[model samples]
Target: MNTLTSSAHLVNVDIELEAAVLGVVLQTPGKAADLLRYIQKPTIFYHSLHQHIYEAIADLYAQGNDCDLMAVRQWLKSHGHDTTNLFNIISQNIFFDLAPKCLILFELAVKRYLGQYGERITRMASDPTTDALQLLERVDGDIDNIMGSIQSMKRPSVNDHLKVFLNGLDGKAKNNGPFTGLSTGIRTLDEQTNGLKPGCLYILAAGTGVGKTAIAGHIVKHQILEVGNAVGFCTLEMKGSEILSRFVAAETGYSNYELDRGKGIDPYKINDAVTRLSDKPLYIWDKPIELIQLEYQASEWKRRYGIKLLVIDYLQLVKHSMVKNRYERVSEISLTFKEMAQELDIAVLALAQLNRDHDKREGWKKRPKLSDLRESGQIEQDSDGVMMLFRPHKFGLNYADSSIIITPQTLEIHIPKWRNGMPTDEDYPLLAYYDAPTNRVGSVPFPDVPF
Candidate 1:
């Protein structure tokens, strides 16, 4: 069997493999549409002819037209794509193994992507004027694109989506009480937000010294750690060791300060906490990351460890090169984080900072508005829900005044914008204990639960 292999001069693309997939699709158009749709992108093919051929067949099938040789040939001619190359894949030499053929082409496309990007990186590196840090950023973005293309190309069809919906609708997904999403284990917060649902993006925005990270740690320790659902906690603000120390503090009821300094806390309590947390599926990445790189890594976490949730320490820290203006950059970041949640079928909880505009509102009234989402209004627009944290006690409000009716120890979780269910009370926020020394946030004194 003579395979139509590409000449050595061309990029290392499998011409025969591309032809094989095309031949199989041309011969078998009955199951062709889904097959082509699974391929998703025509750019996977090495040859321009194969790319157009796939598109023509896909278009024919999509329009409820029969994709016979005559139909495909005519479509190609009408679209101004070459028809002479059609003869290459018209032969009966190829097997009708559609999936395997497509898989090979997918792999080849990734290799070609790497090679192309590698050459570009080398060229950029040779240019002496290029800023070293900027060059590194561009190179990382290019690599991320290659990885992202693989996940993007695996896009599911309508029927594929129908199965997931029907599976849950028919009760095959099982009945687990009132909520169906990943339960944050805070009964009130979970009940309100429906447990940080999949395909939804939640923003935890607050002023500095607020209990945003504490509550996030509590949720992870109490729920995710308990259920053992893998969570990818991307910390842009803090180091892995710092986050881990806080988690330990939350667990052992020791201050993160003492835990880090190794002074007041007992070594055995830290050991016990570490041992218990050892089995939990929590992955922490503590470094600055660009948007594409972050998305690529999250996808890898979803693939490798089956991460059900992604917690970004602070939204503004994730770098973006596409836009020069801060507002546009934040807008892009927020939108991509939202898309990533839907794409990976996971919940994204991004910690963000509220603008200082809230500070002028007087004592015990420093509550953040949706409009106060730091750099862009797009964060509020893109989010499924926005949770803002406000600790009046942090402002040195020693006692609960009659008007405010809150103490310094009390942590107020504000739900100014909730898309799922409206339990938002701007005037009076949800009540929780900060437990500062322990670095824990919850109703507190839970004998059974983790936090």
Candidate 2:
């Protein structure tokens, strides 16, 4: 059997004795070379005791608690340390007499753990049958390590290094230039925003029946079909098929009512709609208020379909696993959406309902201010962009037909907050397009929506 040299050294008495000496010094009043090496190869005996200390230290580090030895010792005591015999050992050895012996014990413990770890690694590597599981474990471990490294750099002193890293990331962002996979359904919005960059949480807010769902469907369809990207739509209020059927109508140039009736519109239009959208890769989940399930489905979607854009039909309908307070829950939901955007590297467009007060406002038919987002202002605070759908026609304005009464749909893409770019100076109504077929919709109509 081929054995590692370090493994032999680890099990040997010489190395054990050396580790014991170091352990004693590490626990002593004086600090020697940071004394953290023993933490790498801890034995079962020391692992128990040292694990407590290490965890306390880690907690302190995370909480920005004082790193003094007394604080660590006190933390250990509070966490049932006072009851353990190991606690006695640690408590008694704060002085110099047992320091050297403690060091020796620490070293022996470390070498034993390393030897076991080495054996485990070898066994995992050599066993061909266990390769898949081993590979996954290794990947998870690597991710944990990378996460640790990232966390370690979050110090004030490392701000310069972090700045450099951030600068590099910014450079990449600039080169990538937002619109890589963005879908505004309008060429102009895509041009301005650069395709709704990934890791961004975009909030669409508007009064009731402002065609929020319609606009979102239009975006999802265009993104999946035209941009050739996989997309996921989570509709809470509407049925999944209902949303998809709308897409069908938009893509087919058939109205939902007409499609349902199967009259008025030509049968060929139905076939055309199916043909246009059926092949495009778009996944949707309209489950009842399951945010966790939404995340789980998104993971599955990414794994199976590589979806690039994810749209939550509206925010209010998104329910969590356990929400004690509705207000607090909304905040959590907002944060979760932000996290989802960053983790999935998918642009998230979450539709939100405007507050009732906004509906009572004088000019709500044109633009919705940031304050109009219902349940949580945090939505506005957390979102990368806030867009409003305002139909002047909904109230009693005729943008399309001059003589007759016409309610033309209007969409205002408000740049209330652009974390990385310049926000628009004033809100302006962008021309909206509603495709009765294929359920597709967009604005600034360079490519006209098929009526």
Candidate 3:
């Protein structure tokens, strides 16, 4: 296979469309500025000369100057770029109407970019030194980046977004139910947070042995079984079978310990649980995966199963090769998850580990806070909501408000940040009972004494 010939054959670019796009920008500067929103960077142009002219026009627009033919020509000349050919092409091709042509050009540019990426991947695959898995991972990351760029090129303006909002309002007004998003099945949490909204990221952070995974599983089960929503669970820490076992326990009220150790297991109950879960559209990827692989898998699941919710077992375990330092890598991963949520239009619930520094704090002060989010504070900044799990019994604090004795299994879900909704002081520390035997978490009734 001749790589060069193959690449050339695959590469597609329409010079006429490119010139028309440039001509429109050169003719109408204001329209050019608006079109720039669709194609922000000049590299989207396949032709080098076109790229240079677009760059000059964008610079002029940025400087609040006219981006007409003469201004762009003078700017290009001052920057030592040859503008004779571009000027000749623009003058020869007079495209007074170029709005639709701009979109066509942008689409062609994206196709060309993808074609070049495919060529690069093929070339890399032929290299003997490149590991196949590494090459595939890199290709996945590149493809995701390309798709993200294409999506951004078509991003809606503020007015377009307003129309969407008003449409949602119309739907909500007609529906009898209160939630516009998927419910977690916990009443107070649902009421306080209005369920989990699409295109938003939520973080559930807790210390070791605090049952963050259990809470996440509870929510996943609720979304799948109760709400009839397809969900994707990407567990980096556990195997697919292990997560299944937890779900089985949650569904059947079976003891996870008994199920895991294969001791005194009930065949009938297992069969019933399997039958119940068999029809649920719940997909799980339990293998260790980088952020890119996770995103690719999530996208595939969303397409195939229409997955509405995604859960990553723990954020700290997600791998990234783009950055070296752990903090920087986690920060990048955090931002990527947030962007992935918005891009996919799904609620992404990621579990995070609280920094161990909280363990060193004084009594009651040991509760996890937004700042205690391990590795990076960016997780808190990027998440639409942050829920920190704190078990008072873990810190040996058995009483609350000098009256009710906190049960050993009482879990406190502390919400320090809620971007879309406000939680009153009474709602700050939501109480839930964690039944470790069944590996399930549920809300406890208010003012109830566990003793």
Candidate 4:
């Protein structure tokens, strides 16, 4: 019997544990399927013979057949493998008493994997040509893989998950709580999404000059100023000063042009805006950052300020050095955002650019769809909610209500995909007014049809 050691040590095979698990499975064929819940992959077994035996059992189980010793032997024989020696060893070493320790087997497997990954990373670091940032990302990915393996061993069953969900519902009802997530300040958007739930990746997509940044700023400001939630905003497109100016314009109702040009701006109002927002827990990283760097920054913000929400201003601008191809890089970034949201237990709202093909389309065909997300469809698939900003007036469509056509054009926020709730179809699009000068967006009453 081999004792499991710390993960820092070199990995060794645990033949005793492997034999015990396989013996129990052979004794009770039904137990093979149950064993899979703890350790699914055959590679988790340290011994080659044990790996073969596990694979045979898994195949039989998947085929809806019993996996007793005879069946396993027959299957191995049919595959031209001599299991006589393997069966003898199993019979001699069988210890059904240790069947409950299968979890320990899974733990050892994870530890072994991590130890191997550490060696690989050390080798990579020794190479002078290896990019430091790329190496860091690779190491982070390996660690995530190791952690995922450990988590899988203890993952709850469907019934167990249902119980926890029902308990949450009961608690919500008892406490008379309605919103389970942070509010976006748009009433209809909040109602439709039940606010932005933690562990969700939301995509806010729009074409150029469609006020995506304005909408994201509005949401972050509402979170930090009104709801008193900490937020981290990462802007790859704009500088920190520019973002701050927008925030000030949005918060104080000052014209962005006036602020930018330093003309006709009241000094007192600017001072007041600065003083009011000085204490808000809003952190911004406006420099160009890769996905890994953003993850580190977001984690630090959460650790330092307990930030509850993270906003990435325009996903297309995020850089990744590991993958050279634009499409694959974007796909990796999108998946990374989703994983980061879930791992950090924070809501991530990422702004994305729509493809230029939408602009080439004719009337009504120009509206952005899920497929129009630039670079990769992974952005649309990975997002928990996809909100596409559309302004018909931008395309020279006149508003029937002439008053509404003035500054702050009517903006239609089309949600093509909402994983938790209903999506916007042809008939319904969330209506809002985008005041570009003030860097603000607010909900508007749905106008009559045929406009």
Alpha-carbon shift of residue 400 in model 2 (angstroms): 15
Per-residue CA lDDT of model 2 for 190-300, tens digit only, reads 666666777789987777766778878777777777678888888888887798788777666667778788778777767776787776787767667555546656655
lDDT of 3 by residue, 126-241 (tens): 88998999888888898787676555556578997999799988987997887767888777677778888889999999988889888899898888877899999999888988
- Comparing 1 and 4 by TM-score, which wins? 1
Model 1, span 359-419: residue lDDT tens: 9887756667787778757887899888887776667663445654556657777888778
TM-score, per-candidate, Cα-based: 0.66, 0.60, 0.67, 0.63
**lDDT per residue as tens, model 4, 341-422:** 9766799999998888988998777888877888757887798998898888777765456775524467888888888687
lDDT of each: 0.76, 0.62, 0.78, 0.77
Report lDDT (Cα) of residue 95, candidate 1.
Answer: 74
Error of 1 at 127 (Å): 60
Ranked by lDDT, top first: 3, 4, 1, 2
- TM-score, ranked from best to worst: 3, 1, 4, 2
Worst 10 residues of 2 by lDDT: 1-10
Identify the runs in model 1 with alpha carbons over 4 angstroms from their true place.
Answer: 1-104, 107-162, 396-405, 444-451
Residue 341, model 3: Cα distance from true site in angstroms: 0.7
Question: Which candidate model has the greater TM-score, 1 or 2?
Answer: 1
Give the backbone clash total of model 4.
0
